[model samples]
Target: MLSMREFWNIVSISLCVQAQISQQLSDTGHTWNYDDGENDWSKNYPFCGGTHQSPIDIYSNIKYDAALTPIQVVGYDSPGIDHFTLSNDGHSVKVSLPATMYISSLKHKYTAVQLHLHWGDQKRPQGSEHTFNDRRFAAELHILHYNSDKYVDSQTATAKEDGLAVLGILLEVGSFNPTFENIQKYLSQVAYKDQEVQIPAFSIRNLLPVTLNEYYRYNGSLTTPPCYPSVLWTVFRQPVKISQEQLFSLETALFSSNVGDSIPQPMVNNFRQKQERAKRELLASFKEDFTFPIAIAFILGIFVIVAIIIYIIRKRRARQQSESRKRVMYAAAQKAEGTSSIEI
Candidate 1:
C-alpha cells in the first residue's frame, strides 16, 4: 500500500540500524588472534596509532623520585566483598570487584573496578605486557581503578587524562599461590567467551607484594584497542610467584571461541607488544640499590670461603702433631737399643 518513495526510505533506515548494530558487535567481540583481513585493529580503532600507547619496556635506568608517595590501598581486605564474578572475555579472564576498595595516595581517590590477566603458552612462557630491563614475566595482572572524585563512572573517566589508575603485578612461575585459588577453581566455568561464574571473594591485598613502595610509574594509554591515553600506570618491581600448575590452568583452560564453534582455539598470549616510550619519564619509587637477594648471596659466599680455610688449617695442624709423636717414639727406641748393647 506504500508508495515507492516511502518504501525506499524505510529500507534506508533499516540499513542504517543494521550497520550500527554490526559496529557495536565488532567492538564488543574483538579478538587478538585474527588472520583474516579484519585483524588490523588500527583501522577500526583509530586510537591504536596514538602517541601515548602502553605496555612499554621499563628500563633499570629509571629516575628515582623520592617524592613519589607510597601507595595506600584502603578496604582491599574488607569482608563486604564476600562474592565476585569472573568472566572470560575471549581475550583474557577478568574478575569483577566492588567499588569499596580504593587508593588514597593520589590527589583524587580512585575506586577499584575490576582486574584481568594476560598470559602466554608453555612454549613461550613469558606473556606479561610490561617488561623490566627487557625481561618479561610468565603473566601479568592489572587491577583497574577510576578517579571517583571527579568522574561519575569509569566509562566517562576512560577518555580523560588522569582518569584511570592501573596497578600492574607481574607473575612468575614458582610456588602455589593460594590467593589465586578462588578464581582458578572456577576458570573452567568460564572457559568460553561470555561465560561467567560467581566466586567467593578473599582478601585482594594478598595478591599484591608485601612492599608496595617500590614501583615504576608512568603515564600511558590502555594496551587494548581504543587505547585511551588516560591511565596512570604503577607497575611493581617485585613479581609474585605462582605454581606451574596454576600457570597451566591459565594457559590451557580457556577457549577463545565459543563452545559451539566449529574450531576450538585456546586463549593464550593475549599481551600486546611493547610500545615506544616517546618523551615519557619512567619514575621509580625507590633507588636501585643492592638488592636483598644479592646481599644475602654475597654474605653466604663469604661464609663458605671462611669455612674452607678453617678446615684446611685444622687438617694441617693434625698432620704436624702426628709427625712429632712418631719422631719422639723413634728416639726412645734408639736410646734403649744403645743401653742393651752396653749391658751385653
Candidate 2:
C-alpha cells in the first residue's frame, strides 16, 4: 500500500547496492560446472564443473624441483574502507564496487576486491586439492584479487580472463586460529545473509601456513558460478591443522544461513570436484627454480631499504673524519705558532 515514489526509492537503493558488487572489470569469457547428479547445490553455479572443477586431488609424488626458501609477503594493513564494507545481511561479506587487486606471483601490485570460502561434509573421501602427503583439510580459503588495470570499471566488470587471481589456502583442523576467532567474535554482529565485518590486517600473509615454500601451482577457474577461467591457482602443499571443534566453529559461523539448523555442519571435506589435467602442469615445491624469482624481488625491495641505510652510515663516517682532520690541523698550527714565538 505504498506510493509509487516510495517503491521507486527502495528499488533505487537496491540497485545502488547491487552496483557495488564487482570492483573490477574482466574479460567476458566464463566457465561453469557441467551438471552432475552428485549435489543439487551446485546445479547452476558457473564454476562448478564435473571435469574441470577446482579443489583437485594433488599427489606428492608428482615431479617437481627442490623447494624454495620461505620469503616474506607484505600486506597492506587496510585494503580500503569500501573494499571490506559490511552488507545488511549477516551471512555474506561484500567487497565494494570495483575489485582492485595485486598478484605477487605475477608481481606484487594488484588489489583484491573480495573473497569467499567453499566447504563440504564432515569428511570428504576424495580429499582436497594440493593434499599434504595425501591428507585433506576440512575447508579452504579463496581470496579473490582482481587486476587493477583490468578492473577499471566497477559496474560492468566480471572476474573474466583479463583480470583475476585467487589465493587458495587449505585449512586443516587442529589448534584454533586466532584470526578465525577474531572473525567469529564479530560474527554475531552480522550472521544472516550478506553482512560483512570490515577486518583490517586481514592479509594473505597471515592466513597462509607458516611455510609457503611447499605448494602446488596450476592454472584453474574460480570454483563458484560465473566460473571465470582466469585464476592462477596456488594451493599450498601443507595443510594447516584445525581441531574438529575449531573446524565446526567456522562451518557453523560461515554458513549458518546456507544450512537449515544443522548444528553447524561439520566441514570434514568441503572440496570441489577434481578437474581434468587439460594439459595443465601441476608444479610442486620441489620442482621449479623456486628461489630465483622470489630471491630477485626480495633483493630488490631489500636493496632499496638497505642502500638508504648504508648511505646514511657512510655520510656520518665522512663527517666524523673531516672533523678529526680539522682538529689535527688546528693543533699543529697552534704548536707552530708557539714555537715561532719562543724563537722570537
Candidate 3:
C-alpha cells in the first residue's frame, strides 16, 4: 500500500503527461503510440506499425512553396521569469514574449522560453529528422515559445488554432560557436537534473541565424505530446556547427550526471509526427528550382527588349551618317565643276 504522498505524486505525474498529450488521441483525431520501450529498434525492431515513430527524417519529400517573412527578434534577456524559465532538471531553457518576433502565417507574437539538446551515444548518422541529407546532426536545439494571447485564460488550453510556435535550430559538427560557450558557463551548477540556475542577462536574439530572412515554414505538431498540432514551425535552411569536442561536452552534460556517468534519457526524439499537408503550402524562402526558372525567363525577356531598342538606335544613326556623306560628295562635285570655269 502506498502512502498518501506517494499516491499524489503518482497521480500528479500521470496528469501532467495527460495534459501534455491532450488525452492520448490528439484533438485532430490521431493516436500517439510511440513509447521508447515499445519502439526500441532491438526489441520492436521489425514490428512497430505506428506511423508516429521517432527519428523520421525532416526534409524527405517535403517541398516548401515559399518562405515566410523572417520572424523579427525584438530583444533577448537573461534567464528570468516571463523572460527565461527552466525545466525541472535544467535540461531545457525557455524564453518568453520575444520582442518584435513574428511568424509569417500566424496571427500573434510568440514568446521563446528555453532551449535544450537531444542526442545519442554517437551522433545518429541518419539524424533526427528521417530525411536529413544522409547525415544526422551532433545535436539539435529546440527553442520553445507559446502565443501569449491565445492562452491568456486557463480554460483555453486545448483550443486548436491557438498561436504556438517553435523554432528548430539544427546543430552540425564544425568549429566553435560563441553562443554555445555562453550557455556552457551555467552548466557548472545546473547541468544536472533538477538543478536550475537563472542567468537573467543572456540575450537569445544573437542565437538566431544571420539569414533568418529565409527558411522553410510549415504546420506541424509539437513533435512531443500531447502532440499538439498547434505549432507553426520555421526550420532554417542554414545549419550552425559546433566542434566535435564541444559537441561531446554538451552531450556529456546532458547525462544523468555532469560527468557523463550514465546516458540521460529525457525526450530522446521529441519531434512530432509529420501531419497531413491538408493542402497547405510549405513555404521556402530561397527556392531554387521554381524561382530559378522564373528568374531566368524574366532576365531573358528583359534582354530581348533591350536588344530591340539598341538595334533601332543604331539603324537611325547609320541613316543620318549616310545622308550627311552624300551631301558632302554632291557639294564637292559642284565645287570641282565651278573651279574649271574659273580656270578658263
Candidate 4:
C-alpha cells in the first residue's frame, strides 16, 4: 500500500547505511605504491597537504644553537635476549621495539616504539628521505618515539604537537656494517606484505652513531599519509656505512603487494620527497664551520695548478732532448765524411 516514491526513498536509505558499513570494514585497504598515489594522496587524506610536512632538505646554512643539548639515548643497551617482531607492512620493513628504550635530552622524556627504513632502487642509488645540502644517501633509518611525560600512550601523542621524536640516521654504502646485520639476516622471512617474523634481540645503541652530539632538529609531520605534524625530527650529522650487498637485500627482498595479489611489485623507493620547511627554523647542535668547504676547494685548486705546471715542464724537457740527439747525429755524420773542416 506504499507509494512508489516512498518505496524508493526507503531503498536509498538502506543502501546508504550499507555503504557506510562497507567503508568502515575496508578502511585498512591502503597501500604505499598503488593506492597512495602522490597526486591523489591529498584527495583521500587531506592531511597530506599539511603545512609542516617532513623529510625536508637540510641546507648547509643552518642556525647553530648551542642550547640544543645532545640527545641522551637511555636504556638502548639494556641487557636482554628479547625477541622483536619484524614485519613488511606493504610499504617498508618495520621492526617493533620494546617500550623500555627512551631518550632524555628534550624537555619531556620520549619512549621508543618502532623503527623502519626507506631506500632507493639500484638505478637511483640515493633514496634517503631527508638530504644534506641536497645530497642524498643510499638509505635512511627512522626510530620513532613518543612523549611519555605528557601522553598516556603513543596513539594519543601522535595527534598533538611535540608528541613524537624521530631520530633519523643516514646510511652510506661502504664496508660491512655489523650493526645492521641483525635485521638484514631476517629480511627473507618477511619478504611479502603482512608477513612477519621474530628476530633475536640486539643492542639498538649500536645502530646509532658513536656520538649523538651533532644533529639537526626541526618540527615536522609524518612522511606518510594522515601526515600528522607532531614529530620532532633529529637527524644526525654523520652517516653510518653499510655494504652494497646489504643495500641490495633491503631493496629486492620486499614486495609491495601481498603474496596473493595479481601483480608482485617490489618495495623500493618508499620515500616521500623533500617537503617545504614553511616558517620553520632548523637548529643545529654544532656550530657551522664556514671554512671547511672553502678550505677543501682551495686545496683542490692548488693541486690542479701544480699538476698543470709539472706537465708543461716535462713536455719542454722531452722536446729539448730530442733536438740534442738530432744535432749529435748530424755532427757524427760530418766527422765520418770529413766535411766539418771544409765548412769551418
The estimated TM-scores of all candidates read: 0.76, 0.56, 0.57, 0.78
**Candidate with best TM-score:** 4
Give the C-alpha miss distance for residue 175 in model 3, angstroms: 1.6
Question: Candidate 4's error at 192, in angstroms?
Answer: 0.7
Judging by TM-score, tell me the better candidate of 1 and 4: 4
Error of 1 at 236 (Å): 0.4
Over 93-118, each residue of candidate 1 has an lDDT whose tens digit, in order, gives 99988988999998899999899999
What RMSD, rounded to one decimal, does every model reach?
A: 12.3, 21.7, 14.0, 11.0
Encode model 3's per-residue lDDT on 138-206: one tens digit a residue: 566667666766565322432244545677777777887877776665554555555665554565656
Model 1 quality (TM-score): 0.76
Q: Tell me the tens digit of each residue's lDDT in model 2 across 1-344.
A: 98999987785454334323322211333222223233532344423343334556675345674543343343433343333454323223333323323455454335565555455454343234444544555766666666556556422334344355566787766787775554445655555554455644354445667777776766676664434455666776666655676555545555434334555423233345555565566776656455999999999999999999999999999999999999999999999999999999
Say which prediction, candidate 1 or candidate 2, comes out ahead on lDDT.
Answer: 1
Task: Report residue 318 deviation for candidate 2 (angstroms).
Answer: 91
Residue ranges of candidate 2 with Cα displaced over 4 Å: 1-52, 60-72, 76-83, 86-101, 121-134, 151-159, 198-204, 254-271, 287-344
- lDDT at 83, model 3: 30
Considering TM-score, which of the candidate structures 2 and 3 is the better prediction for this target?
A: 3
